[model samples]
Target: MTLTFASPDQPAIALHVIDQDARDGWLEAQPPQVQAWVAANGFTGALGQVLLIPGADGAPDRALAGYGTTDRRARVRFPLAAAAEALPEGTYAIASGLPADRAEIEALGWLLTGYAFDRYATQSAAKARLVAPDGVNAARVEIMANAEALIRDLVNTPAADMGPDQLQAAAEALAGEFGAQFEVTRGDALLERNFPMIHAVGRAAEQAPRLIEMTWGTSGPKLTLVGKGVCFDTGGLDLKPAAAMGLMKKDMGGAANVLGLARMIMALDLPLQLRVLIPAVENAVAGNAFRPGDILTSRKGLTVEINNTDAEGRLVLADALALADEGAPDLVISMATLTGAARVAVGADLAPFYTDDDAAAQALSQAAFQAADPVWRMPFHTPYETLIEPGIADLDNAPAGGFAGSITAALFLRRFVENSRYMHFDIYSWQKAKEPGRSKGGLGQGPRALLTALPGMLDL
Candidate 1:
């Protein structure tokens, strides 16, 4: 449902800012009865205390929310969002003059507080809804939230139901909804089309490997999004530990996120030619699974020696990215839950993106703030190019030493996109714990930031 700003006839709810150090001044400025009442009952501005002060006529005056010295950024977003949930069912504005950052933060908190990921659940009573401020974009906020929810739902589903065929179906459904052209290249046809790496990585599975492609819009800069759609990773012949395999169902999170972002782009009708490519595969272990030390030819004509079969995301992404780069799109971006080193560096909350274009990096950083989706820029150190060099083949899909795993993965994908200005995002698309907007489940990374910035990035 849409949210709006205050109406002309409606009464504006006052938000009185309270702090620990500035409580005395606020108390002194209050009326005699209110001051006496507050003094009688010890009231310090300790985070989230709500107190209603009565007038001399015995009526409620305003709502007082305590935010202990708003100098530091709170660890939990709960405090900033308390007003949205705690306040009475009515429109409220920030009555006090807050810092620009905090003001924007408060606005975001209000939007996040309204997020409900109950796609399959039955709707009941309406929860709290707030009006946007003077210049805030309510539609954009809701779009981002809805897109994230879509990604979460797709990733949360089990691998049994969300395999390669389901991945292609999801892409086809999105295409049908947006009236975008859709196609899939499956089975041995993958090999015929020079996607040998994709076939090699996924041929072991009962379901065939397929490339999911969708295109929309006709007259603007070409913006291509390539996502790694490893439906489930059994780690091929290499195999993963039982503990690590627990959350492997979320391996296709990158694909889900791309579709989520595409939903926003299509919904907004952004003036750009959008192309989405997802290489759908399931790295299941079987008798015919690709093994280590095997040489595989990629769509880009690069010979890659497989040092580890577990690093399969890049193999599927290589073919999709090659197809995207063939059109020489102005901007081609790819996202994948590709490496463990990225998780070690930034943890699960942040996605580390690699790009050689300075303008793209700046645009992404700005977009992250605009969309309330946080992403950090990681270096694409060109000197590390030699790390993936193989003695037998042109390149090694998995290097001997696993030093800079995330960086090497980005470099490997770079070999696929020769002409397009490309960027790669290494995301841990699962939240270990619950938070304000992000619940404890499969999380979407990089899409919000990418979706918000695409207009300016492509000069649309």
Candidate 2:
């Protein structure tokens, strides 16, 4: 990973992180020359503002970063990352003014600023380097940063390069790296293995459909993560318009996110038996494509009527969730870029999740703020459960009327898991515009929050 810390013994410049409220007091403590330089530069501690001070030799001796006011800070995330981008190439150490409680998050933000997807095109690497701040877990920060990079890299790739086979390969590689047991059920084997919905949705694609599974950690609580791996969504026979099809390459973002979360879990050696399931497929159009009005039997024996083939993500995830539930893991969480309704409800910045478990919801909500990964707890409204049930079938893949689309989708997936505590994240997984630390490209949502919340949820 490109995101890393400078060597501890290296000579470094001091980075004075000044907030707007404390700017004047800080300036009074400085020498006359330093005070004069600060006034001349118009450094009032606005958010993201950076100014360099010269030494006796006339070279840059130290740097100042603005942390802005409380009101301004509440409006943005990764505030330090903005300053990290503007700083010149050098190793810097935090000198003063950083809040102790926010040290870990700010330190992580600095590392994230170094991420750039340079696989297909040559991209400039971040110039500024940081010394891991005191009291921050340097190894944990590194693991989170590397895992976020993995998610970004996978989602940014085009469908041509990130198809089912490629996704499977990525999972296999991850499993091998952590010495996890990896197994895959591919092509006709899915049919033999009773993943009929997975086979149905992917039958039209050139690449065969498959289920990718990885298991790690033999002790402690059992946790299973199911991610939707629709590599590309042409919307099937209910074809998406060109405008909507532009970013279909990120349809597998759910799978990318779970893999990233798994990386963090295994790297930290969390005391839990972790299982990951991804039903990899490409929803391409052809004669055999699962068409509208088609009724298919899922692994759980629930017959689902396809009202719109565009709603194919839930089909694959249903089969995977059913398989995960069969193991009766202590917790089963499904992450998917499944519904546009979720995006409309909370926009791109927040991950909206549905869960029946109040304890899980509370833990995730609290942890999300601490991790700086925003999440909203959406309910698995029991009253609307009937919306997914059409008279002709056990469930409707795409409910009619669309009053509560995201909720209905969550309810549909919830049907397959009868025994385990379940949670579902409906994530957009794309950053429409650039922000501090988060570039304008494929994005990862909810993973970091889940990482932080796991210990409390499982009592680890």
Candidate 3:
């Protein structure tokens, strides 16, 4: 769905945001007739409660949105979105009572509520539209909403239509739209280019595996994003059960989110050199599929023993991260739906990240709150480094015992990026259930927080 704020000069109904604590006082301040109307409708300002007060002409003159209590608001990321969804089809502007600090997030949430993935089946869009509130950056919020839509579209598409080739097309299209440079090293060329791990993990699929790269910006600190693009993972020779494979279409969520972040960076014209690397592949089972207990050499020349073929996301990311580290970018961040341990650790709503840079961590933590995107910082946990070190190879793709699974995965990816300041995100990129602004489908994690944190992290 296309999301845009109403024209600044357009006629709009006033929307008063009311919290439960101030409900009675707000009622006292209104005209007696309006107060009586609200009372008759039982408008107590409970969370998500919306009431419309009519004028003498029998038309809606103003609207009331319940901000509810702090505890009630704490349960969801975008509390105001509940009202946005419930409002009638008309342009509405916030007249008063919204906290200044919350205005931007609430406005963003309202825009996000417009999203609906109706690619295969018909889906209805939200009817209510919002005007950018005073003091909020409408352009930035719109950019974020559009980027988020791109991510959702890419992730929601099935693997048949979103394989390596299609993923390259999407990246190329994005680059074309922004005048960025785009290139892809596909099929056997990956082997010729020393990306053996990426090739090994994807050789069995009909669609050739590829390393998709895009570059933009000419000056300032360099930032490289490496995203795991396992388009669809059948777990290769170490196959997953039917239940586990059901959501394999979302395996490429990391790539989708990276593209979304790139869109925001380019559209906002951030003063930084940006490079994106995505290893797009489908881990399908076939006679040629890479198997367990097989040792493979990565682009960085580190040998990895495949203890579990299902652990392919980290394998592809390792090669891409090594390539990014070769450039020695100021910062290299790799995102992947790599481990189930992460989902179990923090649940689905919070993006779990690992970073050794305390300043970067601090910036991201603060930005997450401002962006209303939640994140939890996991550790590199140097002591657990030995867990990924198997006797036969430089590292074990899947460390036995399943203990510290997420940490071990991060430590494995870290081995290839020694020169750059690095961070890793083990994300569960699916929203298992619908919330206010977030739909129950493929989700974008960490990108919004990263966008807010970049200026501080890069000293821009």
Winner by lDDT: 2
lDDT of 3 at 52: 84
Candidate 1 vs 2: which has more lDDT = 2
lDDT of 3 at 274: 98
How high is the lDDT of residue 277 in model 3? 99
The lDDT per prediction is 0.80, 0.93, 0.93
Instruction: Compose the digit string of candidate 3's lDDT tens values, residues 1-460.
Output: 6677888898899999999889999899889999899999999888888988888899889999998999999998999998888888998999998999999989988998999999899887678889899999999999999999899999999998999999999999999999999999999999989999999999999998999999999999999999889999999999999999999999999999999999999999999999999999999999999999999999999999999999999999999999999999999999888899998899888999999999999999999999998899999999998899898999999988989899999999999999999999888888889888888898889999999999999999
State residue 94's C-alpha deviation in candidate 3, in Å.
Answer: 0.5
Query: What lDDT does candidate 1 reach at residue 159?
Result: 90
* Residue range with the least summed lDDT across 10 consecutive positions in model 2: 118-127
Looking at model 3, report the run of 10 residues with the lowest lDDT sum.
1-10
Cα lDDT for residue 381, candidate 1? 83
TM-scores of all candidate predictions against the true structure: 0.87, 0.99, 0.99
- Residue 259 in model 2: lDDT: 99
Flag regions of model 3 displaced more than 4 Å.
Answer: none
Q: Choose 1 or 3, whichever is better by lDDT.
A: 3
